[model samples]
Target: MRCARSLVRIQSLRALTAAAGGTVQPAATRKAPHARSLIAHEPCGQALRSLHTACVLLKNRPVATDYQEKSEREGEAAKSLVTYDDLFERAALEAKTKATFNQVLDVFIKRDIRRRGHVEFIYAALRKMPEFGVERDLEVYNKLLDVFPKEIFVPRNYIQRMFNHYPRQQECGVQVLEQMENYGIMPNVQTKVLLVQIFGEKSHPVRKYQRLLYWFPRFKHANPFPVPHQLPQDPVDLARFSLSRIANDLDARVTVYQLPYTDVCETGEEVTQPYVVGIQSPDQRHLLAKHNPSRPVFVEGPFPLWLRKTCVYYYVLRADPLPPEEKVEEPVDPERCFYYPLQLELDLERDLGDDDSFDVDEVDEGPVFAMCMAGRGDQATLAKWISGLQETNPILGRTATVFRLESGVRELQSAAEPEPEARPGEEEEELQSRGVKQ
Candidate 1:
């Protein structure tokens, strides 16, 4: 009976191997039946099972290899797909104007009904807005907000709302609003409507819009001295504007010494003259008139004055601080004030709480006689300005003028100087070459 059971197990093992497409010889075909029975005993069961598993794997090998190849090809194809930035670059190839920018956005909308990869597209658009000169434009921002699909990201349930559904898309929307805020652009009614349609009423982007509306009005005119957006393009006009801004006094008068012009002489050389504009008030003129002829007045600067993004330079005529002995105080005329004394000598003590003055150092610098802006900072150009000043205040000629000009100022090319002669070594080399030829 044991022999029969062993034979039955051997038969079952042979059947499994054959089904797995592996060869198994029958006992009648074997040279020694005794040896075969010993090999197919119960201990051989695990070995037979392992052989069958190997046969099964061999049969499926081709399919596995094919599946791996197919997966690699799919990965390469995914990598080859064009990114959102490529779309903007392609549009910019023609022109990077506002019209081209709008056309690119329009093409993106028409290309896909579902607007795939829109978050990436919006980000790319935001970065490119400044290049196309539409960073401050409200319409472009509204159009960008329109790219997001409506009602998809809006939360359907309280759980979805609590967890901040579609966090990436919401963040993208907020970034668009942030860029608008940076450019000082206020969103319109259409922007609010678009945000509501895309991200629901309680989203982060909506809150940002509410905050902008609440605070934009309060700070719109916050700058006490607001500069004009479009500055004067004419150099003379610009000089006038800058000089008046620095003068501070309403009684100041602007004098244009020279207007910018280009002259072509009979010798066929082009000569360009820079503009000179100066400002002086009644007080400044009066101070200049009292200036002593013994002491010298200094022409100092190309001090920098910034108006918005533009930088301009101006020069000032000032004097050295007088010595303590030379300083004279003007006495007040008591006849002008009949009700009370014009000069008061008081000795009053005050509490520390009553002191309202700022505790800062007082610099006793010399008084500024006048201020001027010119296209050129060279001495010759400034000399013409001084000549012009002598007309209004003749005292400027009597007071010895000293130039304290700094090299920081931009000076225009005054008739280009002749190039220095060749170096001594090069001249000697030329003489040697001529002697060798002889």
Candidate 2:
């Protein structure tokens, strides 16, 4: 009975191996019958099961030689697909004209991983110039300039690293210029402007001055606008006369005082008004009189108007805001809340003082003096005053520096808003209108 069971198990094992696409020996081919009979006498069932398990494990295992052969075939196919001939054929087929050829080359250069950063691709295109029949022009150079990376990224200290890399970028631009020179290509104003933009900040002051001197003469010859004899100096003052009536409306007089620099007028003296008749100068009284004939003039001199040594003192009565609806139990001090002390220093040379007069309008034709504001107060209030001064007196806006006094003097930041970007079609419309007018 045991022998019959062992023979059946051997038959079942052979059937499984054959079904699994493995070679199976016939029963008649079994040479080791004695060994099988020994197994049948012992635990033949467990032995057959163990044999079957070993066969399954061997069948599922991958062959190393077959895998390696498949990989080699795939690699060869990829290499054939990406060869230089294949790439060049595709690019040439896509490009018919010079412009289109350049576009194709640009795409190829940008997309090619091996040739992205290097200029060898450019040289390669130049070699193919005969086939494309396209002569390299300034546009081609500009396109090449566009290919050079303008920015580089660093994982740490990105902003600083970018700034440090700027000189290297400028060097690349210089190399482009040298290449252009070798090709006997003369750069247009636009190309020079591009180089100037890249290398200008790093250039020496003397070179910058020389460039300006060279260009100024040519620019002057073709200039259509009016050119002034001299430009304005710094620390210009702009004052606006208040139209509102004071306590003694009828008796309120515009008194022009040529007081000494040391005199500190009291706030209660009613002299701390916003409006002033005119600036009093000992030497330039006649000039002031000639310009503003109808306005009252006062001559108060001994004020040193020398270079870097002159000082102008202004005492302005702070405008009070309307009281809020909710009444406070305690009265707030006007000196603490409203009035803030301010000092200003003149920032112009004696010679440039005449330019300041050009900035003032005909109505406010007072002497232009560039002055820096020096005092502690609300920045908002200071900004308001500065804007008013700028609107009423244009000279101060252009030339004067208003400094904030808090522990030390610092220049007040201008509150001018940035201009908005024009819409897409607006610029085209403007150009069209301008052309029609011309």
Could you say which candidate leads in TM-score? Answer: 1
Give the Å error, residue 245, model 2: 91
lDDT of 1 by residue, 1-438 (tens): 555565576567657556754343333234234435554674642433324334444664676787899999777555434456777788889998999999989988999999987887898899889888899899999999999999999988888988998999999999999998887999999999999999999988999999999999999999866778779999889888888889878899999999989999999999999999999999999999988888888888889999988999999999989989999999898788889888888988988788667788878999998999888887778888888999989987677777767776445445677766898699767644332210
What's the distance in Å from true for residue 268, model 2? 99
Off by over 4 Å in 2: 1-89, 93-97, 105-120, 126-131, 151-175, 193-438
Q: Model 2 compared with the native: what TM-score? A: 0.22
Candidate 1 residue runs with Cα over 4 Å from true position: 1-82, 329-359, 408-438
Candidate 2: clashing pairs of residues: 235-370, 235-371, 236-369, 236-370, 236-371, 237-369, 375-405
Model 1 TM-score is: 0.71
| Least well predicted 10-residue stretch by lDDT in candidate 1 | 24-33
